[model samples]
Target chain A: MIRFEGITKRYDQQTVISDISFEIEKGELVVIIGSSGCGKTTLLKIVNRLIRPTSGRVYINGADTAAQDEIELRRNIGYVIQQTGLFPHMTVRENIEIIPRLKRVNRADVEARSVELMRMVGLDPAQFLDRYPSQLSGGQQQRVGVARAFACDPEVILMDEPFSALDPLTRVQLQDELADLQARVRKTIVFVTHDMDEAVKIADRICLIHEGGVVQYDTVEAVMKYPANEFVADFIGRNRIWSSPAFIRARDIMIQTPVCASADTTVMRCIERMRTRKVDSLLITGENMRMLGIISAREMQTCEDRGVPVSRVMRRQFEKVSPDENIVEVLQIVNRGGLSAVPVLDEAGTVVGLITRSSLLTTLSRPYLDETEAATS
Target chain B: MNLFTFLVQSAGEIATRLFQHLQLTLLSIFIATALGVPLGVLISYRRRMKKPVMGVANVVQAIPSIALLGFLIPILGIGEKPAVFMVVVYSLLPIIKNTVTGLSGINAETLEAAKGIGMTRIQVLTKVKLPLALPVIMAGVRISAVTSVGLVTLAAFIGANGLGYLIYSGIRTLNDYQILAGAVPACLLALLMDFLFSLVEKMVTPACFKQN
Candidate 1:
């Protein structure tokens, strides 16, 4: 739980940060992202008082950070930097134990925590604890950096471009590990990065900043689907969400209108509606669009009694996806069962939209075609 | 008598002079470290003091050892006091300069991390800056120690007892054997100081810095 209020920083005649304000909820991974020189890093540093704001207030857990002693304030907050910032003189164990030891934590307790943290960050304690920072590869060094931040068990962690310096493969691996780590620890973390893809992958909420001001702060899905302005959309690249399939939800690509019929409708009448609507199946619904079941064209063709109610002939057990479910699960369900369509239901089982096979194909291919069209044009 | 008989005859006296020479060098080095390290650490943080402090040390280094002893003689009478003071002044430049260089040479990221992780200024110095800069600091001490061995030979000029006594007196008397005895032992002491300090340097150096 952290809040920034009217934080402004002026260096000489230039304004580095101007009247920026936002709040990060507890146990949420909020990413502050912008292009270089957009004050994202400066914003992160303000949280720990590494950079004093010219005029503003920062509150952590509702306590004003300025009122707290800097050393005491920082000891309770974890910090990780892009360079890994590990002390080359100290071994991994010492680096990780620095804060806890400074806090006068018991020797045995800190030592045990150092070992556990090493393991949590995917480093073996027995092998890595005594090795100096120079002995580790860049990725391993960053992992140790992460472990060191967690060693004190601080409630809030601040990470500034923690994975930006690593190679692409290692960066991806560290990002996944960080996301997993956050999931397990549930610390309120404020991560800063310039890359939109990374923000989308790991951030619970993305805070987009431009020229020392908040442009858009919303959930990853909301930000992706509805960018606030041209700068926000351009910065997040139109097809960026497509690269992260998880952001492509069922509601985003589903057909809002689907052919429907009352459950009491006779099979003869359902066939007439299907043929007229140019459909192969009908989603049978009760009063208020509540999903009843489905009756495919093939099922209707073999119906012995044409005048029977559609509910009696409909298949009750059917594959479905919620509007919020990502495209990956929708694809899996389609591939696994060879279903022609999947109904999108809301919390109350109301059939809001239909994700037809053709619709899924068009939604997934649009990104590629748009790129090619842009290239040719 | 020939050089052989001369060396055998003066062996006892040479041993005593050698001990005096070592004592002077070690004492000067010890004082230099005590003064130079803290000064170096201070200048590294109080950057305003760096230029003036380094300038003074540089001026001291520019002064010849004989000249430094000459300046000290009037203030501190003709004896071991002047000799030790001259050596300490000469040793200050390297120890202080190296200390500054070493401390400042520490990775900026490491220092930031030190503070970022909530270490007080003192803790950062003790835990990060000093430990990381140790090799360079020790290197300065080694230089000062080895050079001090040769410099202390000038102490004999200030009426101090050391191998320099034999060398200067024998030069006046035209006794080649006495000159050789003093000169040879002083040269060997310099080498020995280097060897001893190298061992210390290795011992204190972090494992990662060591070559396998």
Candidate 2:
């Protein structure tokens, strides 16, 4: 656990952080979010003594961090920054092995650890271990950054907007992978970002700072549902309709028990299932319940004439949403495509539910939603 | 006699002076690097000290080598010692200035990453900054070396043995052959040192930085 008490930093006459106090518990992921110049990065730096506080103290595991040697203290904490900061001259394996080698760990063990870490971060050890940072794409470099951070297996990891430099698609993919890795690894993490949606998605609790002070520090749900003040409300309320509880997801609003079929299943059987369910389309899935595509009645008409399987006639290109994706984004897809329904995929790419126009329309137009919908949007 | 006949006749004299010239340039640069590299590292970290130190180097560099060697004659006396000492002073600026540039030229993010990952101050300098700065610093060494070879011919004025002895003797005796013997070897020596340092630069360059 880490604790910050009355921590403040003043540069000349400008106070960048002022009397900010917070505590992060064991195995918890705390996100520090603020607009630029709010001293959020300053706060993260103080934990490892990168920046000394003008007054107050930070304690790690009950020992004051300032009292410890900065080098030794930093060696025990993992840090990942926005640029990925990988040494351009170092191979991926060498980059990850740096800390372990510094600790004088044997070469064989360090090599094994590098391979394991690369695997943990979803990089293939054989392919990427020898590549330099300049050779990899931005997202690949960031993944190497994360793996390098975890190489020493420190109990606490600090990530400062690690995904912000990546393109949005890669950013979202990394975020999902990070969340998945955190579930398996379970290290206490302190993430800092300016993105509110990211904070809502990954944080166990959020510390929202404004003007060198924390405006609100609470669980994701609490910060969204009950903002402490107008500043907190306004800062968080910008383009963040997804956080409010009144905002339904594709999973909740989807017609659960979606009439889905395995692609290998006969077209006649899929027609029978659709007839029984009174549906015009059937969701197609493959092994591990992965959604492959969809076959509508219009496209399936060719199956009889051509005597082909359903997979042959199924439409391969379509917009699919995850279970957590907001209904607003889903509504646009459904209305724009004139889709009878869109499939809701879980994190594993398995079809969890189906959101048809009527189902989403009724959910969006519900009288109870009007208050939050008006307020958040 | 033809210049080729003149060269063959004085080959032994040329070779001996060539040895002396090579000796003077190498010793001075060796001492300069030993002193200048650490000095550069020190001032880079203590940025305020940089301007004042660089000002002194620039002033030293502005003094013509002949005048500086002449100035040193009274205090250190003439011969190899004073000649070597003065050239060392002349060589320090390039090595020092290049070291400063090389160290300072490293990306801020790379340094932060090194520090953030818990490298000691010394480790960051040696393992990270020095390796990246090698090519730049080597370029400085190359500059110092090429200049020093020509400067060593001036050392004969101070009575140091080198190709400079023949050139000076040639001027006194109105003999172009003597001057050509000294002059040709010095030019060749400068080219040789430059070529060797280029090899050293390539060898020190990190693998990832090498272009395909």
Candidate 3:
């Protein structure tokens, strides 16, 4: 267990992290989320003895970290940073072998352990072992960072926004991979991220830090369901509206059976399908049932040749949003991009449904209108 | 001028003279590195001594090589002692500066990571800090070496042998080729030392730092 007892870090007269106290249980993934300069990183550094607290004690396992040799204390903890901090010159194998080498482990053991760590982090040893850090992508670099942290086989790992540098898709993928690695390895991890969604997604216990001290530290379900104060409520930000659409799948949002037309179908026939269904557009599918285009009412009037194939007259370019995307994200995309409509695509890139501007507007406006109506009533 | 006969007569004398100078310069550099590296490490380890120790090195550097050699001649007398002493003094700045810079410049995170893994102070210094600092220290050694080669040539005035003898002999005889022979080899020696140490620096440096 790692315990922070009355940890108060001050620079001159101003206090950065004040009287922060918490105990992280063994093998638990505790995530700390806060805005920049909230002292989350400072707190992690203090725990690892990188920075000493002005007044407090960090107890690792049972011994006070401050009293012990700082260097020796640090060797017992694994640290991962947002930049990944992989030594640029060293190969993946060499980077992983650093700690082991420092420990004066046998050469054979270091090599074997390096291979094991590479495998554990999901990088094939034979392929990536000799490759330098610069050659790896951001996500791959982070994985190497994780591998390096675990190189010494320390029981506690401190991750400071390790995945923040990655793209959203890659971030989520890595998060899941990390979760799996954590479960398998069962190392006690203190993960720091400003992104609350990531904390909720991966944290065994989410510690919400505001103004240096932890405002709330609890299970994800509790934090999401019952925030401690207005600050937490605001920080968590009306996650209901943000998270509501995540429950939705592409099939649910999509037109179950779209008014589809073949490439050979005349533009007039496609228009007839739109008219019959009272839909604004009819999807154009190819021989392989791939979504080729959408024949809309606008296209019918614009096309000079009404008898032309629907594929020829239909608008091929359109915006798209995944149904699983948060309503907040969808609204942002619609408003920011000035998109009139977006096609919701499935995993196969097949157009499942159309998300129009009106639908998004309605979705966004519904809560405010309902609140206003309730207040009036 | 009978330059051919002059060259033939001077060749054997110059070769033996050059060998002696080269040997002295090389020996002095080897001793300086052996002593300077440890002093640098000691200075780096102790925060209080850093400024003072570096200040001493700076003072040594400020003393002109020729002046220092002349000053040392009074104490040690004209011979290898004064020459070697002067070379050692001249070489200290680069070796000491590089050692301190190289050791200090090691990534704080990497060091922290080393300590986090429970490495003792000696372990960190030997396993992490020393290896990481190798390239920077080698760079310093290279500088010291080249400087020593050039400075050692001045030692001929103090009765130390080597290429400096050619320049000294040329001055007495008014022989230009003798001067050229000494001057060219000395320049070449400096260049060669720099080139060799550069290769050593590259080899010792972790591949990550090479690009930058």
Top candidate (DockQ):
1
lDDT of 2 by residue, B29-88 (tens): 898889888889889999999999999999999998889988999999999999888888
**Chain A vs native chain A, TM-score per candidate:** 0.93, 0.67, 0.66
TM-score of every prediction relative to native = 0.92, 0.79, 0.73
Task: State the TM-score, rounded to 2 decimals, of chain A in model 3.
Answer: 0.66
Error of 1 at B65 (Å): 3.3
Q: After superposing candidate 2 on the true structure, give the runs of residues whose Cα lies further than 4 Å from its correct spot.
A: A238-363, A366-377
Separately for all candidates shown, the number of backbone clashes (residues 3 or more apart, or on different chains) is 0, 0, 15
RMSD per prediction, one decimal? Answer: 2.8, 12.7, 14.5
Model 1 regions more than 4 Å off: A261-284, A293-319, A332-340
List the candidates ranked by DockQ, beginning with the highest.
Answer: 1, 2, 3
Candidate 3 Cα misplacement greater than 4 A, ranges: A60-73, A104-110, A244-377, B43-50, B210-212
Best by lDDT: 1
lDDT of 3 by residue, B17-53 (tens): 7688779878998999998899999999898988988
The sequence of per-residue lDDT tens digits that candidate 3 reaches over residues A1-377 is 99989999999998899999999999999998899999998998888877789999989888888788766666668888854366665688877887777668899988988889888888899999998887888988889889888888899999989999899999999999998888888989999999987887788998889898999999775676578999988898754434635433333344446567788899888778778888786677776556777667886878888887777777777656675775556667777867666667766667667677666566557657876887899
* Number of clashing residue pairs, candidate 1: 0
Rank list by lDDT: 1, 2, 3
Q: What's the TM for model 1?
A: 0.92
